[model samples]
Target: MGSAFPRLHVITDARPGRDALGVVTAAVSAAIGYQTPDALAVQVRVEDDVTDRAAYEFGLAVARICRPAGVMFLVNDRLDVAVAVDADGAHVGADDLPVPAARAVLGPAAVLGATCREPVSARAAVAAGATYLGVGPAFRTSTKAGLPEPLGAAGVAAVAEAVGSAPVIAIGGVSVDEVGELRARGAYGVAVVGALAVAADPEATTTALLKALA
Candidate 1:
């Protein structure tokens, strides 16, 4: 509620052998360089097997990187780590805490995000105090397994229209090239893991993403 939620979310790729912190740092630096730090948000998402202590340490580092740069920092599926690290807020998915519960943990004034794949869920999430809606597999993604088939743009539009003004952030397989199409289809923004996490030049990729959003 302090400021509008960011349009471009750089979700940490904590897959085995990936440098989550390094990717977050690079993304933050890129946001700062563009002089639109506030337009980018960093979400720290580690594997379920990751201990709370490890998640906290990582979230703390990301918060440190994002705070001074004016970028919002959120922890995924770990409200404890979010509160422990004093993150801007937390993001909750189906298997995680409910939107109301997450909002309760973060309290008022914190940015709360909830994942919803369809219109009914999207409306319910917004009604339950979600600050934004993470809606997708707008396209295919290998980052997370066991997801239903990609929603594509039409599915995202249905969710977006249902939620009204609540920002709909299209996730899964999001890339710079698809940003415009997603936005045109009523996606307020996008959340990405592979696009930047595996990029040869994160800064350039970030720049392209921001430009596409614009």
Candidate 2:
């Protein structure tokens, strides 16, 4: 992916189990992992509800394969596994541990993300010290069951406005088709799951998204 900011995060889901999602993760990592330092930020996600083993595998795979400067492990409701693996970062939602608590566990160097479905939450996340705001359901995403209603392009703009200077990452259901809208709306980046995860070629999918965003 030829992202201008060189940032592209790929979150994985266990909702479809290993065979389907695993292949995507592997391909995304291999595809964009070798770009020069200033050209890409690749993250491999291990989203699990109970079994932490998948998270562990995802973290190691990211380190070994993606070899990215950072890897954000989406801790749907757990942070311990993310810490144990020393993942590059952690993305937590409002229902999970608060930002301050996550920061404490993650330490200063570890990036902490907050999922802000609305502007109010986006403001609060910035006030609480989120490294970045995950604002989305830019479309309807089934990767995370019971996800908040679609944010659409307008929702993204609203969150970006609330964040002030903090960077905003549009996530949830975003696809290559919507990159231009996301950028025009002022999202610093985008986080994708199903689009790239279930693709026939993960690397190509990831690259295509980056190109679109650029």
Candidate 3:
């Protein structure tokens, strides 16, 4: 109904080696090569085994590029890491720290996003304090390995209904062909990982995804 955040979260397609400092930086640099920073939200999930110090260092490197483009750094499940690196925001999941706790950690102005698989999850997220809600795995995909069962358009609608005034992002196995249908279903934006990250031309791939959204 009113202005909220825009869509376009491009998940990092690769995982950094457990202890390799260069791994995260290289992966992010490659992503920068794929798409303009501000044009897309770059969501990174630093492996659990990595130390907060390492994650912070990696985020700093990412910010060097992302901050320039006005691109948002969406750290998954690491509120402190986001704060430490001055990230644009933090995206958490149902299983992670609840939205209220995350928001409290980030302060009121910080962006906080939560993953919602069903209507209930969506409602709880907003009630707790998420600035936005991420809903899906709209279709099956390998990127989110071992995620919950897929929630197609129907699930998307349920989340949207719960969102009411908040923006909702549809993530998971979305492809070029599905963009129109997904957007038509009320998704405020789309998130992808392997689809664009694995493509031969990331720039072209990103152009196509943006076009799909339009």
Candidate 4:
């Protein structure tokens, strides 16, 4: 990737019964062990029904883990909690605040991310001060429902071409097997939930994801 943005984004899985913190612990540990901590970003994404307090607590835990390991930490769809926990940044989707508004909330130096699917939205988001673009549902996913159809490698290429140097992180249904093609198609990175969360060995999976991106 041309930018400093991490190539592997390990999104938190906060669904009921999911051990989001445990998964993060393992992933972060793996990143440090590989001496490539900066190549990984951990994004905390809690369910909508969860309380703000709960989100804050989770963000705090993740921050502690990431900060010491020198890994980037971000919160999804919750700027307030991100600020409260002093996260590295936040990611906003269509339903959340616009990219400009999110930039205002996070301030000029924060690493802001905006989710977009096409060239138009991608261009607008970068113009509005997004540090990177999360462009996908790159493939079908069971983690988050009601997402638009998966944007295959070609779709990622379209947004990447439009944005020039801004890093495009291909999200949703991403896995080790798909990372190479996504990168070949112009995706700067890939974001995942189940790929690591449900894996038999999260640390190993994290390493594998990083290797694939390489």
Return the top candidate by lDDT.
4
Q: Model 4 segments beyond 4 Å from truth?
A: 1-3
Model 2 is weakest, by summed lDDT over 10 consecutive residues, at: 67-76
Prediction RMSDs, each to the true structure: 1.3, 3.4, 4.1, 1.7
How do the residues 46-158 of candidate 2 rate in per-residue lDDT, one tens digit apiece?
44454677666655655554444333334434578677766656778767899989888888876778888888878887787788888888899877777768989998999
Which has the better lDDT: candidate 1, or candidate 3? 1
Model 3, span 34-83: residue lDDT tens: 44434466776766787888778777766775666556767888888888
TM-score for candidate 3, please give it: 0.85
User: What would you estimate as the lDDT of candidate 1?
Assistant: 0.89
What lDDT does candidate 4 reach at residue 182?
A: 92
Q: What is the lDDT of every predicted structure here?
A: 0.89, 0.68, 0.73, 0.92
TM-score of 4: 0.97
Clashes of each: 0, 1, 0, 0
lDDT string for model 1 (72-182, tens) is: 889889898989998888899999988888888899988899999999988999999999999989999999889999999999999999989999999999999889889
- RMSD, model 2, all Cα superposed? 3.4
Residue pairs with clashing backbones, model 4: none
**Of the candidates shown, which would achieve the greatest TM-score relative to the real structure?**
4
Q: Write the per-residue lDDT of candidate 4 for residues 70-179, one digit (tens) a residue.
A: 89999999999999999889999999999989999999989999999999999999999999999999999998889899889999999999999999999989989999
Error of 2 at 146 (Å): 1.0
Clashing pairs in 1: none
TM-score of every candidate relative to the true structure: 0.97, 0.83, 0.85, 0.97
